[model samples]
Target: WNVRKTSNKAIHGVYEGVTIFEAPAKIGLNQQAVGYVPTDEEWRFPNFGEDTAHGREFTQSREGTFGGDNGTKSVLPEHKVWFFYLQRICNHCTYPGCLAACPRKAIYKRQEDGIVLIDQSRCRGYKKCVEQCPYKKPMFRGTTRIS
Candidate 1:
């Protein structure tokens, strides 16, 4: 949701190698502390020769370059990078609790909707949602990077 760190801003992820990008700006955005976090939708798929999975592989800027240096810095206006993370990727919610609480009856699911949504207008930002939400979905954006 919102930033959980301030002093030690670390942009972390895992990748086998930089053979191809799941998306353009995958590196620059990540380096710039952009929001698009890798999901199953943006992963390195299996080989195309095999029938496991199919995905296009993009060409790199140059040959022989294995990895690029992530130039991350404090986004304190004077710094070079702005730290940010998008709170959209739902990790299988394996018995998620956020779906378990909603006194306003605002948060609901639709048979055709196929996804859980929160009614922002009803959200009092009681911040109880922050606690109940194991993933901390209810984040309020602000200047300071505090939970």
Candidate 2:
């Protein structure tokens, strides 16, 4: 999950005749923009700056305002804003934290490929694996039982 470039060409990388898709789990934001405004779902690109009322604030404005074009009103103009996207993926360590922290032995590493996996049937929703995972890959999705 090492996606350094912002464009789609950098987001998905092809390796060994296989296309790899990177889904970012963490993002770092910096930079600034000028005269940028948000658009509604109906709005599409190449036709930007339409339907400003249908926009949502990325971060709360500096003055606690909902919509503004300048930095004084909001954090910064939309165009100047920059976000550093980082993708997180399992490293498949020799001794995985999720595998060790699972109380019910629900998590395991495959012998052949060394890929870590979870056995849902053995999981008791303890969430120890989720807490212990350094990369925060083991997420708790709530109970599967129906009442």
Clashing pairs in 1: none
Model 2 collision count = 3
Candidate 1: lDDT over CA atoms? 0.39
Q: Model 1 over residues 1-147: C-alpha lDDT tens digits?
A: 457655454456454554222322454322222122222222222222243222232312244222223532222122222233335555434333444444454454444534566676776543443445666564433332121
Error of 1 at 106 (Å): 2.9
Model 2 Cα lDDT, one tens digit per residue, 1-147:
555646655344644431111111222112122222222221122222334554544334456455555544533334421121122466777556566566676787877778888887888876666566666655454224200
Question: Whose lDDT is greatest here?
Answer: 2
With a 3 Å backbone cut-off (N, CA, C), the pairs that clash in candidate 2 are 32-80, 32-81, 33-80
Error of 2 at 70 (Å): 17
RMSD of 2: 17.6
Worst 10 residues of 1 by lDDT: 40-49
Error of 1 at 21 (Å): 40
C-alpha positional error of residue 138 in candidate 1 after TM-score superposition, expressed in Å: 3.2
Give the Cα-based TM-score of candidate 2 against the true structure: 0.38
